[model samples]
Target: MESSERQLRAQMRFFHDLVRKLAADGDPYAKVLSAPDNPYPAYEAIRARGVLYHSPLNTWVTADHELANQVLRDKRFGVRMANGDKVPEFMNFDNSMLGLDPPDHTRLRRMTVPTFNPRIVERWRGRAEAICHRLIDDILAKGGRFDLMTSFAHHLPTAVIGDLVGIPEEDREQFHLLSREITPLLDGVVTYEKSVSVHAALDGMAELFGRIVEQRRADPREDMISRMLPLVDEGSLTMAELLPLCMFLPLAGTETTVNLIGNGILALLRHPEQWRMVAEDPELAQGAVNETLRYDPPVQTYRRIAHEPVELAGVTLAVDDELAIVAAGANRDPKVFPDPERFDITRSSRNDTLAFSAGIHYCLGAPLAKFEAEVAYQTLITRLPDLRQAGPVRRRGSFIIRGLQEFPLSAG
Candidate 1:
């Protein structure tokens, strides 16, 4: 094996051992997702190893926010993780907006950014509300306890994003499955089994998007896809760049908002006093959403690779070294946020909430996602009038994304 590949294998072995130990020890490390802190205990554990742990694939974890900002903003670290030989459950390689670097990144993000811009996303308010209203009605009609994660939380954003991105309501379930198979890309294991399913799903999506692009070409509409056609005509964006954003933008929009809604509600339920405050004045709900992001963000960590030598926190990383910016940890560093452990809904905003990521690679759907969370929560609070956690919130074991897998809730 090449030296980088050897390094990757060595690192993977070490991480596996760490995971095993954390699992055995339980508490903070193993239940990484159970609580609000970044890396859970994972950050501190890795920090103990050193400010930077050699990534098995030339990757290391930079859990410090300032260091994270330095890496993400400095333009030295590339976003793509060096995949030597292993293909985990997801092939985050091509198509997805999150995986690509600049030039191509510039083209892809440009096509969709206009659509997700605050002015445009603000226009999505009515459509987002309509979708939420229908879902809430369905839940209320059932008149019993419901699974918030799957039922209410999951469905609302998918419907909202589907409407916004021109995805037919019928295809959302399929998209959800495809998104689930691919979300593990950040976890560093794109297994063969998942690869088959994910490839099939991606092919189907690409084919579907191809057809849509063709339709938009023949008959333009008032959607983002139509607006993005000029880029394709200009040859700045190829089908690969366009296809991923088409699906990715919508999926990202839905996924993060869904988790934030679920996570925020759960947090308030655990802290009833907070819930009571929001119940009294729904405007505070927006603050609650921001707090939940800091407390437990939907997207956890993102990986970057160094092409040239880079110095971080006095440690000089050799060329080809890998780095994982634990956005979760960066959001909680005590130096950045006072009492980072406490869940204060009204904590003044920090310029950096690595939750949306940093540098040129920041999330495209951030405004849309935040808007959806605020709107969704407001509608629910006003409509449900009394929403509370109904059962234990189950968490998915995947490392990249965090939040409720099953958030059982009731509305009165």
Candidate 2:
């Protein structure tokens, strides 16, 4: 048997023991970062805990690309691995659109589609650059010293998503906190205090969306929330369903983009030639973005259960056994992406990479993600001119979302 395959069988026994320990006295935080230096290396040994890669608690960590395409495409298999009793655990249920499938997903997606249209994306071209400029300026004004994660990568996406959703300029912080709090990757390891803050953020979002929905009902605006709020007024959308859309959009919108930008920058800084390539030929921004997604996908894993016995890579999974589609690992799978680890942006091959996933559940925010990164990096290379990493940076203590927590950069 192949190494990965052999490891899978061994994990069946090893993972159960690990889970038993974790259930009792394991420190989730310490266990998460136990192999922070090599996060992906240990994934093979952990997936056999009932077919789903169980984390210390509420874990979804996989990186296989083709499986991602299969799982994401099969809409019947939704996110049902939750352990929420008081409320749907992991992601707050709250009757959100994400929990709804088919007619609901179709209807909500139709309403949400207008905001992501090509023309609307074109409208944000300047807005995207403007946000980039504002962020870069903050760094420049600070004498080329800034936390790229907090100061730039983190702020721009929150601001941009806010602008898209009709959030007022002053209220961006609320959205930012919500984006961070709601990501399982970030808060899965949060303490009781952070848990309080996460709930507070959810409450704030619900309240904010209440007003926004009401405002849009009275007088529709050009923003996305305005476009979708009418359905609610017409009784087409209810609080239970609508709350998730309002919160999910910003969190989904900004969360991954922030990580993508941060990861892309770090990857390029590590590979100066690639940086110089983008710096020289501004057009390479798109390909560079694609490569970044393949190299270190922001959302590492998505899940699906076998409706029937499924044969994936010769591994026969039993019916109803949970399967983790590791987008990051899939992106690196040699079968799909040749020389997966070299970080070569110019290497052209079929990009069936599991970054955005595939099929019906393919990331709804993909068009937005690609557009945002293309615009942001194009501007970064051209405007910043001297963007370079300052020192060693750390990731956001997250196993699911991949990116740096602190990226210090100097832009001359």
Candidate 3:
């Protein structure tokens, strides 16, 4: 199994290198990195090329808000090839519903919806609040400067999702350690070593969840795994299907929320007036969350492949042609938003953002993620009224997922 896996990774690495060459030599992706802290200029270049610009790298790129929404909602565009092939040339990771197209996509997604129902997720609010306060207390106890991403942002969502998914507390550290390695593949820039690490992390997580599945089958509890066990037993969902669903929760829940907190806080701090606004009125926490998502979303790029020749943005996409919908750029479209560059929590047009994306593939845990950020930010502002940046920020090295990997902050 290990040898076969290594061979698969060798193929993936070769493919990644080929794609990198294509992107660097010909694609807009080559020019998309304006700076570690800002990629909007790169996105602006793509937008300037017109609504639908064809890349020499053999993909169609769009930063237009209407075009992005049309492509996402259009039935002709999907996550996979027309004939059902996976598109992860950098890593052999399958995102379940995130990878599937309708009837299959609809079926699998429907089964998971009840688990993430607004009411069910709302029940997690108290726990999310408690986690926020406990983390703040610990950071305060340590006295002066701490890495916000590591100390608070990363751990909070990991624990919340861990609890929600019913992973045994003793086993969660190993789970998170592995997830940390695997999440970067979302960026689509995988080195040979990183691909190997991702494979190992996925395998280890599968094993951990496998054990939990068996435990839930034997001694049912009030957790998500237990809730879904009956469906697995009766064949509404197979064991094979169950594992990925369990894996998706944390995979979906963690890094995005972590980045949201880190990026949103940074945005607020950079615009001190906005920070003061949220700090003064805790009610603006949700407004802050919305504005940050619009200004600097966690997931920066979304992809779709045409299932058939489809006319869009005054051009027809041949079957299997990839569409790189840059939502980060779309969120700032001046047609939809005035002064698109400014980060304002009070802007009425702010809700026009495509941060959680649009249409069917929109984030399932968006409510939970929003609530988590709200609580984290609200608590931080109220408790650490004097919070300020202590050191240089290190942005994550992936254009697809925009976030700060390390943000040093101090509370006076």
Candidate 4:
């Protein structure tokens, strides 16, 4: 009964805070939470405010490239409060490396680093290429017209991560379903309906991985889970730690790549000359992927909490104060990338974007995501030269992890 009451209180507080923010003027962070189709304008508004605008939500917000980069790399900042309080339950990432500070974060991240090292990721290129070809074959068999996201973008990463994690092919479909249900929690749950659905999805994910861990223990295989089970048994890691890492891996590995492919393809298609460049020289697929990471990245906003009072860019942040680092905005800062608004595949300054973040929390799956995207673009341009948008594009109703929900296209 007390737990139910606490949940109710949290819900009420969330709704009230949401309403106040939406009603408040000049709060670009509020506009971000509203999840507009194009959040760049709100980001620009935040930039206009200053390097560090103390938001009505009581968080410091920044869109400046240098400042955002500083905050990301600063050791004085962390994902959790300095007082060691966990983030709100609705964020749904508590206990994972993403939600941990150093020592724990360092330990967990070290265990997984080799799995996604550039050298290790390169070994999977052939398999990734094979997966892309299989997906394209399926797309072509469907009479040339299909939703790019559902048919191609989502499947490639799902298959690749499934292979890496040892998820049986038969269980892959069900596993992805649970992942999709839980991803929106990254935006932080506001409504009771979303809260209920996400919790249920978390429960389902726990149960699914619980079974997988047990099976891998009984008869280990040459997969990530099998490798980690021994650590859990020996107490180098606890089941509590192991389970969340299991849940985090597939979610992180799949969702971001899904968006990266979708956003990259959509950007190329929108820029005919850029599409032609890649179609003419498929080697430019890597360039297209990099440019897309700058122009329309999968992740837009990253949150950090100040571990101690620190002065930054002429503003002082109090201990435990939160920061909303708008990476998408920083990606477009004219000071860093000349002609920042333009989407140029050949842009010389394309690699400077904060899409994968930086410092201790830099994306662990970045190399794999980039490799998968490079293969995807290379294969699509080579095999489906006639690819073009056939219908309206639909953006995901998310502000932080930006991407498409439906991107209709045809292979002419």
Give the C-alpha lDDT of model 3: 0.83
* RMSD of candidates 1 onward, in order: 4.4, 7.7, 2.5, 1.9
**Model 1 poorest ten-residue lDDT run:** 82-91
| Candidate 3 vs 4: which has more lDDT | 4
Q: What's the CA error at residue 88 for candidate 4, in Å?
A: 2.3
In terms of lDDT, the best-performing candidate is: 4
Compute the lDDT of residue 233 as modeled in candidate 4: 79
lDDT of each: 0.71, 0.66, 0.83, 0.85
Model 4 deviation from native, Cα RMSD in Å = 1.9
Ranking by TM-score: 4, 3, 1, 2
- Candidate 4 has its poorest 10 consecutive residues by lDDT at 185-194
Off by over 4 Å in 2: 1-37, 43-64, 81-95, 185-193, 306-320, 349-351
In model 3, how many backbone clashes occur?
Answer: 0
Candidate 2 is scored at a TM of 0.81
Q: In model 4, what lDDT does residue 368 have? A: 90
Worst 10 residues of 2 by lDDT: 82-91
Q: Candidate 1 on 81-111: residue-level lDDT in tens? A: 3332222313244447666667667766766
Q: Candidate 4: which stretches are off by over 4 Å?
A: 1-24, 91-93
Better of 1 and 4 by lDDT: 4
Q: What is the lDDT of residue 287 in candidate 1?
A: 89
**Segments in model 3 whose C-alpha atoms lie over 4 Å from true places:** 1-27, 33-36
| Candidate 3 lDDT tens digits, 296-334 | 999888989999999987788899989889999999899
